[model samples]
Target: MADRKEQDALIQQPDAEAEAEPEPEPEQLTGCGASALCDPRRKPHRFLVLMLMCSLSFGSYFCYDIPAALQTQIKQDMKVNSAQFMQLYAWYSWPNVILCFIGGFLIDRIFGIRLGTIIFSCFVVVGQVLFSFGALLNKYWLMEAARFVFGIGGESLAVAQNTYAVLWFKGRELNLVFGLQLSMARLGSTVNMNIMGPVYDAVERYIGVESYYCLGITFFIGGVTCLFSLACGLILGYLDKRAERILHRKSHGTEKVIKLSDVRYFPLSLWMIVMVCVFYYVAVFPFIGLGKVFFEEKFDFSPTHASAVNSIVYILSAPLSPFFGLIVDLVGKNLMWVLLAVSTTLGSHCLLAFTFWNPWIAMVIMGCSYSMLACSLWPLVAFVVEPHQLGTAYGCMQSIQNLGLAVVSLGSGAILDMSGYFMLELFFCACLCVALIFALLLYLINLFQGGKLNLSTRERRKLEDQSRS
Candidate 1:
C-alpha cells in the first residue's frame, strides 16, 4: 500500500507541475454569463439563452416533419411514388453537404456566430415561404428547390446551435443542456406530426381537399413555426453579442483562426465521430422520413393512426431526453450509453422487421433509445475538440451527415420501391451496425490513448492541460 501510494504520487507529480503552469482557462461566467464576477451565489441568465437555443430550430423541426406526416396524402394527391416523396429529404440534405461546412468555416473564421445565425435563419424563412408557395401552386420541382434552400440554412443553423451550446455550457451540464434542446426540437416534430393530419382534415373541411392549394396552405401553417424560430434566433444573436462584449468570453492568445489547413489537423477520433454520426443518422432519420408509410403498410394502420404511431418516437423523446441527459451527465459513460442506445435502436428495428409486436411498443422503445443517444452523442464532440474548432468540427460533421442523409435517404426510398419496407429495415440495421462498430472502435481508441472523453468537463479540461504540457 505504501508503494502504491508512492506510485500514485509519482503519477500525479507531472500533473502538479502542469497545474503550476498557466494555461488557457475554460470559460467561466458568474451570475449566468452576466457581469456578476463578484456575486457567485446564483447562475446567470444562461438558461434563458438555453431556451433561445432550444427554440432556435423549433420552426425547422416543425416543418421538417410535416412532409413525413403528410407523406401518404402527398403521394396520393400528387400522384407521386415513394422515391419521389423521399427526394424532399435528398434535396434538403445535398446542398448542405458542402454549404454547411463552408458556413461553419465562415462562422469560425469570418462571419462569427451572430451573423451566421441570422443569415441562416433568413434562409430558413425564405425557403419555407418558397416551399409553402410551391406546394400551393403544385410545382413539385419548386418545392424540392425550396427544400434545398431550407437545407442550406438548416445545416448551418445546426452548427451555430452547437457553437452556442459549447460557448455557454461547455464546462457545465452540457449533456443535459443538449438533451433539453433536442427535447424541445423533438417536441416540435411530435406536435407537427400530431397536428398536421387533424389540421389538414379541418382545413380540407373548409377549403375543400380537391386542390394543391390546400396542401400548400397546410404546409404554410407549419412554415409559420420557422418564423417564430427566426425571431428567437434574432433575440439570441443580440443577447450573444451583448454577452461576448460584456463577458469577454474569448481569451487572448487562445483565439484560433480557422483555415483550410486546420481541417486536415482533426484527429482520428473526430473522423470516427463523423462516421458514427453519418451512419447512425442515415439509419435513424431517413427511416423516420418514411416511417408513416411503413406503419400504414406493414401494421395495417389507418393513415392518422399510422402517423401518430410513427410520431411516438418523437413524442416520447420530447419528455424523456432531459432525464436521459441528466443520467448521462451523472454516469459519465457517454460512449457506453451511446452504444446501448444504438444497440437498442437496432433491436427496435429488428422487432419491427421480424416480430408481430404492436408497432407502438417498438416505437416507444425506439423513442427512448433516440433520447438516450441524443444526450450522449453530441456532447462527446465538445470533448474531442477545442472551443474554437467546435463550429468547424460540427459543421464538418453536419456536412458528412448530410451526405449520408442525402444518399441513404434516396437509396432507402428506392429500395422501398424495388424490394419493400422489410428490406429497408434490413438496410437500416446494416447502417446502425456500422455505427455500432464505430462506437466500439471509439471506446477502444479512447481506452488505449487516454480516456478523456468520458470524463466530466472539469476533469477532462484538467487532463487536457496536463497532456498539453
Candidate 2:
C-alpha cells in the first residue's frame, strides 16, 4: 500500500513540478551525517552568526598586539627595562588565568553566552580606555593596572567566542568554524602589526615623534574598535534571543550546571589537548611579541620591514587557516595534522635559533602549521566531553594556556633583557619541542583507542552514534 501511494504521489508531483522550475539535484552530504540531522533553517544563519563571533572579539585582538608593536617605544617612554616590560604581559595574562575558568563556569551555570558576551565586551572597552589614558600619562603602574583590567575581559571574551562557535556549529563543520574564527583573530593582530608603525609615524607629524600622546591616540583608536565590538555583541544577543524564542530551543543554562567534580570525567585525549595548547602558544606568542626586535637585531631589517617579517605568520594565517580547516574536515586524521603542525613549529623555531636562513620561510611554514594544529586541536575537546561541559573544557584549556603564556612570556622577556635574543630563541625552541612531544603522544593515544579519533566524517558516522560528544 505504501508503494502504491508513493507511485501515485510521484505521478501527481509531476504536474506540480511542471508548473515550477525543475528541482536541482541534491548535493552530497560531506559533514559527519545527513542533512536530515541539522536544521535547514539554521544553515543560512551560521555564517552570520560566525561573523558575529569573529567581530565581537576583533578589537580585543587588535588592541592586544598594540603594546607589542610599541614595545621599544614603551620602554623608552617609561624608562623601563625588559624585565619591567615583561610585567605588562604578566599582568595581562595572570589574572585571566584564574578569571577565565570562573568566567567559563559562569557561562555554563549562570549567565548564558549572550549576556556573558556583553558583560565581557564591556570589560574590554573599559580596560582599553584605561590603558589608553594611562599611556597618555606615562605612568608605568597605571599602565600595568590597565593591563590587569583589560586581561579581565580579553581572554574571557575569547572563551565566550569559542563557546558560541561550539553552540552553533557543534558536530557539523566545527573545525572549519574554528578556523574562520582564528583567521579573523590573526587578521586583527596582523593589521595591528602592519599598520601601527605607520599609524605611529602618521600621528607623530601632529603629536610630535616622541610624545606619549602618540601611543595614547593609537590605543584610543583601539578602544573605539572595542566599542564597535560591543555594539555587535548587543546585536548578536538580540538576534540570538529572537532565534531562541521562535525556535523554542533549549536554553543552555536551564540544563545541568557543571559541577567542579566533572573534571574527573574528562578523557585522556582532553588532557593531551590542553598540554599541547599550553606548550605551543608559549613558543608562538612570546616569539611574535619579540619578533620585530629579533629581526631588527639579527637580520638588520628596518623597523617597518621587521614588523612585516614578524607579522608573516599572521599574514599567512589570515588566508590559509580556512584552507587548512577544510582539509582537516575532509581528510580527518586530526591527530596527524596536529603532529604535522607541532613538528613544523619546532622546525621553524630551530631555524630561527640556529641558522641564518631567511626567517620569512620559517614563519610561513609555522603559520600554516599553526592554523592546522589549532583547528584540529580545539575540536577534539568537543569530541572528548559531553556537550554541556564544553565551556569548562575550553575554559580549562585557555586557563592553562594563559598560565603558559604568562610564565614563558615573562621568562623570555627577562632572557632577552639579560642574555640576548639567542637565549630567548633557545627558550622558545625548547617550548616547541615539548609541544611536539605532546602531539606525538596524541597520535599514540589515537592508535591505542582503535583509531576512532582519526576517522573521517563519513567513516565515523558508520560506527558511532552522532551525538555532540
Best by lDDT: 1
Candidate 2 residue-wise lDDT, 1-469, digit = tens: 1211211222112333433544443334446433332322456565666788788878888888887888878777778888788778888899878888888777777777788889999999998889988888877788889888898888989888888777667657778988898898889889888887777778878767556778888778767878988998998787666555434353112234578789778889888889999999988888898888889989999988888889988888888888888888888888888888898888998899899999888888888889888788888887777666766788888888998889987898889888999988888888888888887887788788875667787787665453322
Candidate 2 lands at a TM-score of 0.88
Q: What is the TM-score of each candidate against the true structure?
A: 0.89, 0.88
Best candidate (score: TM-score): 1
State the lDDT of candidate 1 residue by residue for 1-469, as single tens digits. Answer: 1211211222222345545656454346556343542222235467678889999988888887778988877887677899999999999999989998998887877777778898999999899999888888889999999999999898899888877777667657888999998999999999998898888788889987675778888888888899899999998887766554443333222233557678898888888878988988898888989998788788799888888888898999988999998887777778888889989999999999998899888888899999998889898887777556777889999999999999998999999999998999999999999999999999899889986766654576577576756
| Cα error, candidate 2, residue 205 (Å) | 1.1
Q: What's the count of clashing pairs in each model shown?
A: 3, 0
Q: Clashing residue pairs, candidate 2? A: none
Worst 10 residues of 1 by lDDT: 1-10
